[model samples]
Target: NESVWTADQNEEMSNTSASPDSVSLADVSAEKATQGSDTDLEVEDPEKAFAGVMGAELYLEACRLTEVVPVSHFIQNLSKPYVNLNHHGLGPKGVKAIAIALVSNGTITHLELEDNCILAEGAIYIAEMLRENSSLQELNISNNHLDTAGAEAIASLLLDNMSYLHALQLSGGLYALKQSHCVCTFVSLQGNYQVKELDLSHNGFSEKGGQLLGQMLARNTTLEILDLSWNHLSRKGTVALGTGLRGNGALKILNLSWNGIGNEGALALGEALKVNNVLVHLDISNNQINNEGAKNLCRGLEVNGKLKILKMANNPLTVEGATALLASVRKNHNCMMEEINISNVLVNETFIKLLDLVCRMRPELDVIHGEVEGCITKIPKQHPNPMKVIQKYLKEHNLQLWDFFRNIDKDGNMKIPVAAFRRAMMQQQNIPLDRVQIGELVRQLDRHRTGIVDY
Candidate 1:
């Protein structure tokens, strides 16, 4: 995020996994149970029958799809705590059979039923099992044909008196992710006080649905992470959510990216941050937030303390809003953010200035962004205001670009030696950057791949 790199800072960051629990099984053995790894017991196929799916075509389908003969062969042991039947060609018949077994079994805590081609009735059976189950903690029911009614039925599990469900991951396949039944699909989960993590990303729930989910957040106490990305939440919907988020405590991370939430929506969320103390991370990228909205968010930070990471990349913020946001963190002790991302928001010059200011003023808070466009696009060779760009960028870090350039300006012209720029950054600002870091900065300023940055 910044030029200062630690010895052990893994740079990769993204959340897209194939399995419900995409954790490493390395060093998984009885001797090292406390060494920090997800260890699920693996046993030989049990001979006992799963009477539920014994004679059904679902069993035949599972057997044919997977060469393991019987799909239930792996889940037959009543003591086994993990049941993963993902992509096993299980339809309604298969899901109902498994549901029948789960109704009586009380051992498994994690269940994966993704991409099984199950429909409404199958979802109903699973919902019934949720009504009675108590030991289960994670449920992955994505990629099934649970139409509107089926989805609502499962959603009502939140209202069930006995359902102790925690994490509900409905991040489904292409069809399921795009198909939404309407507001009812999620309104049933409103006021739910049990689940902690809910992933509704890639779904098509409308703004009305988003509003209802907001109402749920107001009443919920256990929910911590909520992912509603690409759900078409507009400003009105987000404003409604802000009403709930204003005082919410359990919620910490909110991902509303890839939606239609505009400047008003961002402002509303910023207002929420002013009063909400629990939320620490927020991702509102790809929205319509502009300069005013960015300023409003900065104002929120001026009074807020809990928010640690603000990811606002891909918005339409200009230099005015970007600098204000950075300055708020710099001026106010209340807004001690660990990371701020304004990537792809402003132009080449403006972005450089804002980035440099944050890097110098708050060395602990890393600013994340991408290369500037002008440098990348190779603006006019006889650029008129190149000096202004460089000076503004340097001023942000409390350094004079002219002075730094004068020492290396061999011809006494405005142009400076590109090789000396890296050394100047270290000498003037005490920011020691290696080749990788210096090369990255040069790319931002040398958009045209030019060897020298005249500005």
Candidate 2:
């Protein structure tokens, strides 16, 4: 009798609230949907059920965590209320189909279909969606194997349906932006609104692409951040880009990392900065910015007042380059330059000691020296080579420092806990995820159990 009463009470409680189909997808995930086994129908409104199905939390988590989702189920049921849809491994046809469906429905906003098999025709479909779908805000189709046709499709979308897009990331070898034979200019400014950020990094763009983008910038208004990293923008390209920056007012962050911008290119950027005052962050890392280039940058810093954060890491900046930055910092009383990432440029004891002194003197600027010392655990010289060998293996595998610790207060999942130490470690290692660690491969989070005994 008591068990029956309890069952009745439980059923009453369950019926009074929402049902599974009516459950808020804002918190639920595809993993949960796949894992759950409940089939009982409960009393719930259709509106609530739809809200739950298309909630922001559920779709975002699904998009962010799982790189692969079944194309059919996702299009039919899942993509109702979500903004970002990052079905990474889904092929171009699948993505285009999904986008077409969403645009037809007129609900999706902020689509991010990065790291997929999307190419030319697929890009055109997305372009069509952009032109017609006025609700979508941001589009990131980066890391896809797209060519000139795809670029032209995107460019067409920019000219027609891409004004609302505040952020666009088309990085990772879509095509060469500067090839002589290519028809599409990097991105035309005909209808592009003053987009806040644009990342064309890692695309094969040389002098021609740089010059094309420069021409767009001369008249275009509103883009603040531009990332052209990993492109082969030689000295000629940099000089051409400088022409656009000479009198620019709204642009701020410019990333030319890994572009091989030698001293001459660096000099051009520096000269542009002398007059351009809006740019705050500049990343010239991984270039051949030798001591001469560093000196030129320092000269620009002296005259310029707006530039703040400078990242020259992984360049050929010897101790002399460090000295140049240190000298510039010493001169400015109100040192606007808050951060300088000089990790592996080979700074000797003298430079290190001088850096220590500079930090001790100012105590305001946080100069990050990413070189490993006894920070994690001391790798003793006298230890057995076998144990050392094991340790090296663990460190290389990223299971040495710590394990994935989840939050007790929030979601009870194995993720990188938000701790000061963990955040610092991630920054040093260049890991970008808020709750996951960057494993060996791109978009692959480290999931191996870190074999460390907790005290």
- State in Å the error of residue 135, model 2: 2.3
RMSD of each: 15.6, 16.4
lDDT per residue for candidate 2 within 336-430, as digits (tens), equals 66567787765555666676666544543445554434424655333233324435655776764333232111343333332222323334433
Question: By lDDT, who's the top model here?
Answer: 1
lDDT of each: 0.64, 0.59
TM-score of 2: 0.62
Error of 1 at 357 (Å): 4.6
* Model 1 residue 55 distance off true place after TM-score fit, in angstroms: 16
What's the lDDT for candidate 2? 0.59
Candidate 1 lowest-lDDT run of ten: 6-15
Candidate 1 segments whose C-alpha is farther than 4 A from its true place: 1-69, 72-81, 172-190, 346-357, 372-455
